[model samples]
Target: MDTIPDNIILHPIGVIRNTTKQPFLVASAAGLTMQGDLAPTMDRVRESEETISEVILKGEFTELLEGIDEYSHIKILYWAHGVPAEGRSLKKVHPMGRPDYPL
Candidate 1:
């Protein structure tokens, strides 16, 4: 059998600063209501980037969200940290998960 490396690596980039108080439970709630004051609230995912606010980026390696507002819309690619290790595994989607179907 091939020997595996004994070392592990870890790096954190930023914090998701939302109006989401109690993110753990609120995020986990099944079909949580976004009515009233919580009507699909909007907030920034704080990062340690030089262009962003300091109160948001409390850690190192957060220089990613800078100048993001210049665009009308921004696409984000990320993994859910709360998901289990097995859940993070890749899966083949139908049509390779393409947005448009073949004519």
Candidate 2:
């Protein structure tokens, strides 16, 4: 089997600033179940539709965003810094933690 190299490294180029203070759902350390009620979760989702977040790039990386305003939409990649280490190891999960969905 191929082994991953040990010298890999990553650095954040920017940070997202938003008003959201809590997550819509919380997963157990084992990633088997989600805590919180579905109604409130949906409410948060609705609230987020009207929320605006700012993505501030580091001073050194600011130039990389030149001409970004010309695009109507863009894709963003982010790290889930709040997830527990064990939760990151989950191989499968129900969509939106809805048990009715197949894993």
Top lDDT: which candidate number? 2
TM-score of each: 0.32, 0.81
Best by the TM-score measure = 2
Q: What value does the lDDT take at residue 53 in candidate 1?
A: 23
**Model 2 residue pairs with clashes:** none
Q: Write one digit per residue (lDDT tens) for candidate 1, span 1-103.
A: 9999987565544444434433321222222222223222322222212233223443453556678678895544344576455434434322312224331
What is the per-residue lDDT of model 2 for residues 14-88, given as tens digits with 9 covering 90 to 100?
889899887775566555554467787778788888998899999999898899999998898987788787876
lDDT (Cα, 0-100) at 41 in candidate 1: 33
Report the poorest 10 consecutive residues by lDDT, candidate 2: 26-35
